[model samples]
Target chain A: MNCEQARPLLAAYVDGELDTVRMLEMEGHLPACPACTRAVRELQQLQQSLRQESLYHPAPAALRRNVLAELSAQARPEPKPAFWSWFRLVPALSGAMVVCLAALLAVTLNRPSGHEQLTAEIVSSHIRSLMANHALDVVSTDQHTVKPWFNGRVDFAPPVKDLAAQGFPLIGGRLDYLHHRTVAALVFQRNKHIINVFLWPGSEKNSAPSLDSVRQGFNLIHWNQGGMTCWAISDLNPTELLEFTRDFAL
Target chain B: MEARERLPAFEQTVLPHLDAAHNLARWLAGNDQDAQDVVQEACLRAFKFFGGFRGDNPRAWLLAIVRNTFYTWLRQNRPAIPTVELDDAALEVADPAAAGEALQTRQADAETVRRAIAALPVEFREIIVLREMEAMSYKDIAILADLPIGTVMSRLARARKLLQKQLAREYQTGGPS
Candidate 1:
């Protein structure tokens, strides 16, 4: 076969897609034809370079968590209303149970306030950043270095401090978009666990000094100081997280 | 199948291909954020309809879903960039002289290679990514790309030739060694 016939077949030939007879014909033709030979070699080199290149990006851990979380949520069995229906049949106990149920339902259905919602957002974001293996945009242990890195990234100056002497070393900071606005997420390391402290400008003056909550297996502490709302979240024990927050707050 | 049985089957069949799915999405979507979004949506769809899956090749099946998801996303998010049919003639490497520049292409760095592949049209880009980077066979690519084997082969040829031309141009323009 000449160059024209061989030209279209070269890719298949290189890929081992050709039948044996065709492969033999192409192999025989390659030694006699320099141009076809050069094309085949070029195709091989391109394939090699492509394989060597870092082209395949693994799905980030956050994506895995998000997808798995969504799958588990979908797979979760629907709440069994049959059990509740059976509980409603006892007329004598129904009066007391109905009142108790009303109070319980009221507590369960109450929507979280803006601050509480922000706390949940903070914990999820912290988990996502860690799971995504993007824990820090600027990694440093020095307080001076971590503090200045957030300049101009957010509207307010985020307070960054080193509590390494107290066992919480400042790791770095990342710019996070939370609650429909950009906020500062300062990272600190307590032993092996990471603590994400999200800071943003406070909306209310002289708000409560501190509030603590837990959600989705994470502990969160929120506080307002000097016109900034700061939230520290981690999987670390609540006492340790609160201690770290206290040192930073002071 | 019951929901419990479906979960295990879906996990066994589809979850192992998460990286492959994300890799294709990342290349197609052109960024991490969009790639993640596309993969998430694709996984949800895969789980929802997994009961209907009859094919034996789960990786290819997942990849096909990813390809479809990416297109739908492109259509909704980027209406201006129509998914135009790429002319095979336009992608042909006319200059036979560039074939000799294979040595320079061999020296091409990862960034240069990435830029060259990124410059390809979506169809060409997807084929090359599947065949070369993902190391999928022509038949498997045919399955994922929803094309005949001949079409897959010719498109791959055209894609490689386009890459050669791009690399040659880079060398001509003094791309980093």
Candidate 2:
């Protein structure tokens, strides 16, 4: 490859993304080409100097307090009745089954199903929405203005309400889809925790409000309110979430 | 009892990374105060979604949030970038030539390089901070910056070249001397 061709691959080469053959070819060109060789040396030095500098500094004490407070404020207890229900059924199923059948049931219960993975996928959607600039296309507290902003963006208007009087102030509304259907995420804040309330119209009775807790240390509360299903995910305590939900739902 | 016991364990695993989160925030936001706020907000958001994080690298996960928070704040505030007027009184001495000599002598030390790195443009400073201070892989930096990995690599190359040139000018003029 010519210098023009080799320039772009240089970065991939440094990053170890190139295959063996391409890496060997780049290495061959490096020795003969002064510019390519200089580029490699300089890039290495830049990487070294950056690694050598002090990047990780302790946050101010007050800042840590602020973050914790924000977290504590939004945390609410998730409904874990489903897990208990499932566990409760496990013992009953074993007692009724024959000894041979009991062994077969054990293998089935241990494996994670597609529904559990769906929860992970939903949380990922939440993370990506906040990561990208699409958090709120129209930033406002006016329900009339924020609710209409989703028009033409999605198929329906998400229920936007003003809960500021309840201490969970309305930030704005945005269009988001989850669980193979168009969903509305109404953004609100209790102190500093931006609560993401995912809403979708469903008639399944919301499955008795189950709390799915991940072993990696995240919490999710899925409940059915009115005609919509609400999945409240946050790092807050389940008790805190329950309190917030009780107040917000009222 | 089960829920009560889980909180402390989760905190122990995740809270320790707060400082590293703040440092990346400081670099992205370009100030101590904004850095504090941005990192705090990111922490809350990360905690809320902590369930989705799985068992992977928490540091990288948290840093990505901090980086995103800074960009969000930057867009909201749209705060005017305070220009580093080289025309300041402390920089301007009786003799134009003496300033150069003094900068060189004083800047040869690592401390000066540290300060100089902070004084670069936001784009330049971010690349320097991510590459040097954070020791992030180019791919990681690209992912965090929302740029292609190739752009991250080239930007680092240019950032270093500019920083070195700036240091040379500062030192060669004897400003730090």
* Candidate that scores best on lDDT: 1
Position A224, candidate 1: lDDT: 82
Interface RMSD for each predicted structure: 1.9, 6.9
Q: For candidate 2, what is the DockQ?
A: 0.16
> TM-score of model 1 relative to the true fold?
0.58
**lDDT of predicted model 1:** 0.84
Q: What is the C-alpha RMSD of each candidate to the true structure, in Å?
A: 33.0, 36.2
Instruction: List candidate 2 stretches off by more than 4 Å.
Output: A1-19, A29-36, A53-56, A60-250, B1-13, B81-109, B175-177
Once model 2 is optimally superposed onto the true structure by TM-score, how far is the C-alpha of residue A226 displaced, in angstroms? Answer: 63
Query: Which 10-residue span in candidate 2 chain A carries the lowest summed lDDT?
Result: A46-55
Report the lDDT tens digits of candidate 2 across residue range A43-62. Answer: 55444544543534578899
Model 2, first chain, TM-score of 0.48
